[model samples]
Target: MKILKSTLIATTLLMGISCKTSNNHKAQETGLRDAYKNSFHVGTALNRDDILQTDSLRSALIGKEFSSITAENIMKSMFMHPEKDVYQFDMSDKYVEFGEKNNMFIHGHTLIWHSQLAPWMRSISDSTEMAQAMESHIKTIVEKYKGRINSWDVVNEALNEDGTLRNSAFYKTIGSEYLAMAFKWAAETDPNTDLYYNDYNLTNKAKRAGAVKLVKDIQSKGIKIDGVGMQGHWHIDSPSIEEIEESILDYANLGVKVAITELDVSVLPNPWNLVGAEISQNFENNKKLNPYPEALPDSMQVKLAKRYSDIFKVFLKHQDKISRVTFWGTSDKESWLNDFPVRGRTNYPLLFDRELKPKAAYDSILALKK
Candidate 1:
């Protein structure tokens, strides 16, 4: 009897250990970073709360799941350089620290952008003064985090929907030369870091052609343009796989890497067929627009899963040309989609839901690895 009891106890202990080990293995398989570890760096943008560690769940999820991180807003000019002389490094400092702690590939969001320009910088009309401000802005930010940031969006959204330059303040003040000037300053500031031109709607033929021309122009000038960022602010139905794939190949053909930056698939219906990610565009809230205010229905959830799976399929097919795929946010609750293009409407646009639990979309994306 004593021998039989001892054997049973030993068997029970071994079974417990086996169960724990299996659970851990399953968890590892589900992580985004681990699922695509061999393919590319899986990444997400970090908000201020994530940087401060105020929300324990978000902080932990970011550290565990993403292999790269982009500052969602803090690194932008309005936030980083609110005044000519004032440089806010507190939040951005914490951001880089978090990335370093997790051994993440830190990507500086933007060195020059027209949307969030400070008033002082925007009001400068003289070409020389504008050039000086642009150089100072790019060099100051780039020099501060020179070695720490592995890559940068040297310029963001400089082109319009019709493939011409947007005539932004930079363009109006300094002409189209500002594009090359921005890349040049960033390259000079940090020769070791990768510099990229980031924009939206590269899938459109006209915009794609414009991007090709832009990159080729920079390259022709002997500038070190490393990659192009196709902002993946997509919807469930639009931007078919063909467009995405074609855009990827076209950008790669430029002899520069392609990154799917700011990726998020909005599941909500497009209000008046919204196409671009212009933040100023807004529509009033109503039942017709904000369809799933309470909860995402089962059918919609399945649709979202299929959307994500199809998207990842494209990413995997051309993983060689792709360097990183960074989701715009970590979870649905924190996604910018919740506010942009519409206001105060519940939108489920991420792999994780509001409760910080992985949804069907997450499972579907992980299954692609098999």
Candidate 2:
């Protein structure tokens, strides 16, 4: 009897140990890069802290899950060139180094953007002066990181929702030729790097048409525009699977690689059906707008998972044309949606929860690979 009891206890202990090991192995194996290795490059945008390796958990997760990285803010015009003559390369330098250390496909965000322009650049009214300033800004930044940076969003958000070019400061100053000029400068600066034009709401019919025209016009000039980045800032219900697929095919037809850039599916309600990622748009936070404040209900979690899975199915169907799919942020805790359109709202827009644990959406994405 004593021998039998000892044997039973040992069996129970061994079973527990085996189960624990299996769980640990599963957790370590949940990597986006590995699952989508054959399909396309899986990437995520990293904030300053992530690039600096300040948050060890985030740093490790980013390194393991993503095969490519984009600087969320450090490489933007406002941050990189805040002052006219003063270029802040410290943080951006660290950003490049982090990508190099990880052996990631490092993509520079924007060489010319209307939104985050420096005060001096935006204030330039003369055509010649504006041209010189723009040239200096693009040449200096692109030259400094010429060989190190792999690709760039040469110009971002240059079109309006109605399929017309936005009359931005660059446009008002340098005329419509500025778009072609920006790409020309970037191409001249780095003949090797892939240059892309990025923007939001590109899935919209009119906007997509505008992008098509924009690409063709640049190519007509014999300039190198390698891809068009469709910023996938979608809601759980929006941008039907058909529309997503159509946009991919449309952009692919243009002979430029398609990239799903700045992707995040928001599960919260838009205050007034607000569309597009205009940073200037904001609303007062209230209970109705900020639902799921403390915890996301199980039903919503499942819905988010389904949304991501369906979207990836479209991506998988046209994998040959797609070059990269980069999530805007790493985890829900760091997601920009939480604060955008509405402030102080808890948002569950990413595949990882606040604790940095993989959510159901992450599992669903991985399951598609199998």
Candidate 3:
């Protein structure tokens, strides 16, 4: 990694256009958490394996660079509450403990979602039973982490691209109104904690309109809602800077905070021209799409760095409306990109590489001061 020379880049940003030298050298010493501490929290999603401290280097990096923690999968429905009468807390307990020990802003990944539905939950044949099950699940989990977790994604990926409800089991049985009920139930359980409706393709006009409607409908009914998480599952050269910034302002207008949740910039080529990050999609891998299977070329690394820098510049511009920007995973190797739309394709989509070393993108992001 090269020190961003004090003259060319640093001076230009830190000192201004007067060609003066900056005395704010402390920015060089602090990690990203401090760099953007005043603007918004810098966070990353973690798994039990990372929290257990299996890799001392990665664990240390998490503690140093980030000020917020979110469970990548443990807090999901399947892993947290897998049975009708059973609830698993071993991993979640550890995750909370880790957050407390590190003084991190702990965030629950999700509470209600059409995906990752518990097997027993799927067997419900009546709307009444399904509603009861949803209420019970939210109450139990929210009560357990009442004061532990800071905020929650009350629902995840619940809207379609056309601004209508995705016909998942919950939407089909209980209808779009079920989304409101879900937030109400969560608020009843833990009114103090923040609640958000998180989804992908949030920058798209139709999808964002649907989200804004959900928030307005809930608030109009006197239900508690805190934020709308715009999952930044993006690729290079797409989702232009103007588009993302526009989405931020739009979500901010809904009288709720906006979060860039599940953020990662995939460098690999796409198998097909897809838009949002849906886990169900997959295609056979081709070498053209999986070009850099071993290492990212220098030119691509620079591109990745600039991409992140440009995004953060937008985040800084909308600090009042934004609460947090969380990377989808800790490192490139752990990123779900490898097997999502294809199988066994390496990707460089995170600040840290496979070995957990900070990449050029990290430095570029740090160079961006608030």
Candidate 4:
């Protein structure tokens, strides 16, 4: 890891252009800042810059008052069980250590998900064995990080677009009841930790309703759930502001912590093609590549930044309900938005650009002073 002369970078941003005048709407409300000064947890996924070979990225993060650390894929079941029964904790442990070392809150990404599960988990046939295995895995992982992790996303993306349970292996075997059980077990296993249900594409009425019902069901069962994580993977155009606000309000109504997790706004050619696929692949490689042709132009980048600013401003307005805001990765170089669903599509969907410099989006977010 090479050290970046951040003094130079900060100077450049300061001199890039005059600061734009902010509308009163963007201004912090009275006491809002002090009330939740440290509560607004801005974060991103663990990346190569922070972990590969140096602390240059970590040093960069230190300058910002980040609220927490998101493990992203590190805490996923697949990463933890890459070879089936062979749990490797090296990388994920390093990240957890990094969070504690920095005194940043740690968000354990997912305990259950449909996409990242190992084949063995999906291949199990006997119901008894499956349930027992699920219990063992959850108990072991939760117990291992009992004191260290303050929050755990016990279930991730379990709802389909129509609010039905996705036919994940867990659902196939344990049925929808698994969600309630998972939350209950997690609370029992780590009584001090907050349990959350995490999901993407939740900025819609159907999905929001489904989530509310799920949370209600768990609570009705006397479960000790604490929060709901909305994976804020938005497009530049879709997921209208009304929808976003509604989603937040709906979840907050449940009396739980609402988090904007895995946030990134994609700006690229529509319909998502093969070039997008290549871009996604390259993003994970952690090496520099040519920017995607359809990426936001400089003007678009500014618009994107302003969009994030507006959203953060809204988040501040609802600070009483929201607890955390996490970007998907440190910079465009490491964001999962680049490689997911589509591969090689170039996109600038985060607060930082490839250079690790705070783009307008960064300033826009910081402007939300209490």
Better of 1 and 3 by lDDT: 1
Model 4 scores a TM of: 0.83
Candidate 4 RMSD to the real structure: 8.2
Name the lDDT value of residue 347 in candidate 2: 98
Model-by-model lDDT, in order?
A: 0.88, 0.89, 0.86, 0.71
Give lDDT tens digits, candidate 3, residues 185-224.
9999999999999999998888989988888989999999
For residues 263-338, what per-residue lDDT tens digits would candidate 4 score against the true structure?
8887754443222112223323222332455445555656676678678767877878888887777778777656
TM-score winner between candidates 1 and 4? 1
Clash number by candidate, in order:
0, 0, 0, 17
Candidate 4 Cα errors over 4 Å, as ranges: 1-36, 52-55, 62-65, 83-85, 272-295
- Error of model 3, residue 294, in angstroms: 1.1
Report the lDDT tens digits of candidate 1 across residue range 1-370.
Answer: 9999966765664444335334546645568887788999999999888999999878888888999999999999999998989899999999999999999999999888898888889888899999998888899999999899999999999998889999899999889889998999999999999999999888999999999999999999998899999999999997999999999999999989999999999989898887769888998888888999999876676677778889999999999999999999999999989888889888998988898877767777876886
Stretches of candidate 3 exceeding 4 Å from the true structure: 1-28
Q: Candidate 2's residue-wise lDDT over 1-370, tens digit each?
A: 9999966765664444335334646645768888888899899998988988998888988999998999888887788888888999999899999999988899999888898778878888999998888888899999999899999999999999988999999899878899999999999999999999999999999999999999999999998999999999999999889999999999999999999999999999998888779899999999999989999876677678779989999999999999999999999999999999998899999988898877777777877886
Weakest lDDT window of 10 consecutive positions for candidate 4: 274-283
Candidate 3, residue 217: the lDDT equals: 89
